[model samples]
Target: MSPWVADIEAAVDSVLQAYHRPGLPGVSVGVLAQGEVRLRKGYGLADIAGRRPNAPDVPMRIASLSKQFLVTVVLMLEAEGALSIDDDVHRYLPDLPDYGTPVTLRDLMSNQSGVRDFLELRLLCGGNFSDPATADESYALVKSASRLNFRPGTAFAYSNSGFMLLTLIVERLEGRSLESVLQSRLLSPLGMTQTHLARSDIPWLAQRAVPYVVENGCAARGEWSIPLDGAGGMISSIDDLLKWARYVADPASPHAAHFRRMARARPYADGTDSPYGLGFTVMPYRGLDSFGHHGQLPGVFAEIAWFPQIDAALVLLANTTEINPFHLGRRLADALFPAALAPRFPPEVVPPGHYYDPGENRVLRVLRQPDGENYLDSAMTRAPVEWHQAGRFRPYWPMLHLQLAAQDDALVGHDGPRAVAYRRLPTGYAGAPERFTGTFYLPGLESLWRISLHDGQLTLALTGRFGTRHFHLTPLTDEVLIATPAQAPDGHYRPTLRITGAHGQRRLMITTDRTSRLVAGEMLPSTDR
Candidate 1:
């Protein structure tokens, strides 16, 4: 290995060792230079009970990084005249709802397909889909909702549902399961012995590293709602992924030059916004044009970043959600490969406000919430629901938002730039206040919000593994709620909340609370009568 490669490996080990705790479990790292694996290493224990350290050969769920590989297959097939990226999705799956305009494969690849994300709509319906077939139900749900976040070829929003729809198109055109197509084309041809399509019920992988979640000092296996076939769902070992990366990046390797075209960013359909290349995230991260995708499931956090200009890339995979692979890997690259690395984005630089609806902001004013005395003394059912932060719960200010409509009913709201969706329940709580005061768990975070009604107002308590604290909720109007924290000596928490619901179940109830410190004499407005 090159001396720089050795330094890169050592730096990675030091960071992981310094920040990692015993309970957080292990991670795998692979570094690619000039189209080959220059360094591969593993850290901590994969199975803590067995004292088994993570290894390069161990298979891990690549999550969204799998998108790069899936899109590669599509592009290669296109190059072979097997299919066209510009083909309409209805060409294969005619069953998809035709919303007057057709969505193309290119639109899906770039996330410009105006179709609402299936998973976002799925969560809105109180429907659960964990496996492949049932996962398709999310798309059907999106069709039933019949709402589009934007017109096809309009804007850039990361949408998993778009990738999933591409997977369906791949299957229908080839007349083979996405799993079979991948195994035959990518993994098999590349000689990736350890990599394979992930199955939700894979018994062998359970014994490998065991995706885990901790609750009350106990670690248990956790699962995600991602489909197994194509899109962002394949599993692989760091060693295998490194090899696959080499095959794609190597100019002399078969089909290598052809695949590079897929990585190149292109124009959106309307040519109005920056386009997402075939499969990879084609953007300038810190001024360096990088190609990679970030992936997260229930128990895994991953990122694979490749700077094609330098022919250098980094892959980081951790079993714990707390360990953000993307930030860590970027830091490692900066520390180890400074000259070729991308410049850091300044903190104060404002990102373009693409998702903003000025009308919504007109009705909303985000304010900071007061703090609780301690973890135990804090109320759970108040505005600015406590979010898990840096080993403790801190109040977050709700980014107050409003949507104008002729009818007073539930509505759909899209998650900022990520394209996720939430149901906006009608905000008339005076008659049925108790309906909003039950327990609800934040998906993926495992945090809980408990609300209780008393004295004609709502008392909300926020809790997680750390336990419960209280807050006050006073409905200002049919569409607004103001949250006050219990212990207000140092204005530490402010809650602004929006509730979204459908049918008999609440789909998305969000509280954006601002956390602040107490200032002398500003009395905490409490609903604790």
Candidate 2:
């Protein structure tokens, strides 16, 4: 009967109703405070065509968010004197290739193990990991990568391959799968009966939400082709996620306090620090410390955020890959706790002296260049101007609908059967071309992204330990500009970057990089590098 409970309920309802469009098959939400679940809700139909309503108890794919649960299990074992995070992977999984560098459990959890991501490399090699038969082979493909990309703990890069290795470690040490460990140690005790690790065959899960995709600008089903199952392969309803939130918030819970050690940011072996905790991304939200994880797979978009200090958490799950769960969750959080959120921005009252650019222009002028002003460009390639002609999954699909599909690198728009090679050009402030040149370092990636400018317009290119990337930037002031993909074409995941710094060792903050990588690109001083 607490007054805050009513606010939480209304907030949840508002978020679901606003984002739960007809095309979206289903969604689940959970809100908790101080070990008490305030609300657990579901909306829309699970199997829309089949007329199966999405129920609060219907289990659905949870995806990468499952990493947190797996982390909890590892911590629990650590607590029970079963294993140590510092233990090297070779100690248990000796069958893994001897890559010279020893990868430890903490290295894997922090995503600093330097193991190449299996899914990325596989896709680059004409392989599909989601096919039921090929899923099993993903592990071996990743294990055979011959060498670690970097020394353990030197940098932070998300590696599904590493988490898969963690899952294997659990199986080897506990004599059971990660799913079994969760069921026995955490879920069973917490009474989360509705959650389950997804298998290829779950006929009884007929009531589960149907994931959707966007194809040729229409709604379709997301491809069930991902290879990492255990790392991102669980399904749960809002009721079950609520139970999870409570368990996480409960300080007295066996697994709760253990997170403190995992939560503390650690220095990587290469002298950089990681804001990521075991399976959880540690971030500062609204001036308070928060812990949570986001999941992405074929048909699911999920975010679970909790303020450990206040004991309040919000979770949002969508059955489509196109939906922005973070935006939806933030809305609900703001409504539930208005004191913690900023007021809504009014109409297009542009901030004084803001510049605007049209398709034809490519010039930029930086009005003010502070001593610490740094510059960075993300969209190095240009997207076709005609939005409709561009790839369907570019900007709109994942932004508005939560639809997931393959981003084919070789895909070229063809009217009949010919390839259309596309490229993007850079423009400067207010379309004024201001050229910039610098070397950028993405710490999490332990790679370099180079930028070159010509005639006031700029083209940003990335070449790293993994591969190459392209981005575009338009300057507004001597220091400000809006950054997005030059074109909304397929195959490229464009990120917006705002640069700030002096002549060297500049810092580039990615205003919007969904995966949270490339947040800040720092140019290490020549003396340091």
Candidate 3:
């Protein structure tokens, strides 16, 4: 190995050293450079009970990283004159509820379909990931939606429901199971012998790594019973991923054109380019153009990034949720190409306050940590801000960058491809939570929710198939409240409830990171209350 290659391996060790010990579930990392496997190593244990150390060939659930493969299959079918990315999705799945606009395959690929994410819907229905669900149940959950989050192609919102629908379309067109189609078209062709679409109800491979969730320093096995589909359900090892990466990075590969097409950004309705392309996130990291996607499930966290400037690809697959693959991937990239990284300067400090976006009825809080670090706070996440210049900043998350400049007493900027303007709210602005107290019905999912006030605190209760779940509602403004589950199943599922209209005609709009505009109308006073 050359000096640089040695340095990279050492960097990987340093980054993953904490998980290198025994008796803990860990990760498998693969690094490919110039069409060669520079490093393929596994750290920690794959099966703590069996004392099996993780290896490069230990199959693990990759979650949404399966999307790239699904997109590839769609492209292959398109090449065969079976479908077109620009064609309306209803052409293939005509039974789908019409949203009064054409939702094309391109919209689904770029996450602009405005479809509600089925996973979030399941959570909203009081169903956890561990709950047993069949493919039909999953499909029914998505198909029951009466409206789209927004007009198709107008904005971007990540939706697994779109991909699930794509899976149906692919199956309908090919007249075969998605597993069989993927195996015959992509996995088999690339010699990815150990990679295949996993089924939730079947027995796991003996060599597969056991997924674990660490709570209070204790590790427990994670369980998932939702059926596998094209949205996310692939299992593979580092070796197999490396082989796939080599093929993707090869300019002379037969699917080179398709890969390039997938990497190109697709524009929203306003003609502004989106950060996501076909099943891939297109962004620049350290001044290097990159494309990749991250995946997360109950206990799995995975990231696959490809930097064309350095002709390198990095894949990190973890069986435990304790580690963030993006952070590790950034550290590994820094070690491999330190000289290639662009220098970053501290961002110009803005007055810490709550900035509200009127269009989306959302608020962004600029908060200062005790350590003097600044963070951008939202309902579902708190990401540290790393400023690139005076007004431009990039958060410590993928596919997100922003520039906030003061304009007409407002913070005007763009969040990725979406233009946004936020006005600082008056300090101590609190909404009247009592005004929203009542039972509401969502006809889309046939779900009912009750907003109640008890001891000066508001709670939103949702009753569904599993049971009832109560979420603590914290007022953000006179019209918006952040509903946080009293005991979040995954500890990260929160949605914002925005109240609109006048006193007697008020409606609720629920939104999450991956879902938006789930409207619920107030039900008439009845005995059900």
Candidate 4:
């Protein structure tokens, strides 16, 4: 092995040492250089009770990393003249509500379809991931959305609902199940015999790693009963994925044209390019050009990053929620190419406080850790910011290089092509929670929310598939409030409710990271109240 490769293998061991201990769920890591596998190994146990150690061949749920293969299937169909990326989505799935604009397959591929994410919609309806759902049911859920987040192709918003629609399109064209189409067309040709889609209706392989939720040094099995589709429902081992990585990286491969097309960034309506391409996030890391995707389920976290400049790739799959594959992939990349990476500097100190963005009607909490690290908190996500120069920093979420610069009275930046500014709010700013106390109904979603104030704390309660869930509401501005689940299954959904209109005609506009433009009208006082 070369000196650098040896150094990287050692670094991998050091980075994964924490998860390599006893009674813990662990990760399966693979590294590739020049289209060759340099390191393929596993750390920790796959099943704690069985005492089975994770191995390179142990299949695990890759979650959304399944998108690349799905996208490839779509491209293959296009090549066969079965479909076209430019074709309107309604051409294949006419059941989708007309949003008064053409939403093409390309828009879905590049996450520009403006479709509301069905998972977020399900959460809004008080449904949990553990709730049982069928493909038809999920399809109906997606079709029930009466509106889009924005006009198609105008902006970029990550939506799994788009992929779900694509899956339907592929299935309708091929007249076969997505699983069968993927296996016969892609996996079989690549000789990936061990890799296959895991459907909710079928039993999974016994050799698959057991997913766990590790807390306080204890491991518990994670629950996921919802049906798996093209959105995120595939199982594979590190060995099989390395085969895929090598094939995609090869310049002379048959699918080279498709890979290139998939890597090209899609431009917005105004001509600014998006960081995301067809099912992949195309962006620069440190100083190297890279394209990859990250996947997360209840108990799974997976990352695949390919650096085209050096013909190197890194894959990390973990069967535990505690593991962060994205950050680990970066660490492995640093070890693999130390000289090529840009130098890091301390983050510019923007005073830790609540900053409100008037354009988006949201609040961002800038927090400083005791160890001097800085983080940006938006809705339910918290991402670490790495500062490269004075007053400028980048967040590590969404796989987008979202940069923000500290200004005199505001932090201004661009999220892809859209400009955003977050002005710092006064310290200890509080809103009158009672003003938002009322019952509201959203006609589009057929969901109702009751906002109540008890003992100086406000909460929003809604009932659906999983029964009633009460979310604690914290005021961001006098008119904006953030709602968080009061119990377990936390962090899955944090939506912001903004009050609009006058007293008698007041309404609540709900927005999440994925779905927006949902408004709920306040119901009149009934006899029950």
TM-score for each of the candidates: 0.68, 0.65, 0.92, 0.95
The positional error of residue 106 in candidate 1, measured at the CA in angstroms, is: 0.4
Summarize candidate 4's per-residue lDDT along 304-328 as a digit string, tens digits. 9899988888899899988667767
Worst 10 contiguous positions by lDDT, candidate 1: 514-523
**RMSD of candidates 1 onward, in order:** 11.8, 13.4, 2.7, 2.0
lDDT for each candidate structure = 0.56, 0.59, 0.80, 0.82
After superposition, candidate 3 runs with Cα above 4 Å error: 1-6, 350-355, 365-373, 388-390, 399-411, 423-435, 500-504, 527-529
Runs of candidate 1 exceeding 4 Å displacement: 1-6, 128-133, 204-207, 214-218, 225-227, 269-275, 342-529
Residue-wise C-alpha lDDT for candidate 3, range 293-313, written one tens digit per residue = 888877788899999888989
lDDT of 4: 0.82
* lDDT score at residue 360, model 4, on the 0-100 scale: 75
Number of the top TM-score candidate: 4
Which model scores highest in lDDT?
4
Which ranges in model 2 have alpha carbons more than 4 Å from their true place?
Answer: 1-6, 129-132, 201-204, 215-217, 270-273, 341-529
Off by over 4 Å in 4: 1-5, 388-390, 399-401, 429-431, 464-466, 490-492, 527-529
Q: Sorted on TM-score, highest at the top, how do the candidates line up?
A: 4, 3, 1, 2
Q: Between 2 and 4, whose TM-score is larger?
A: 4
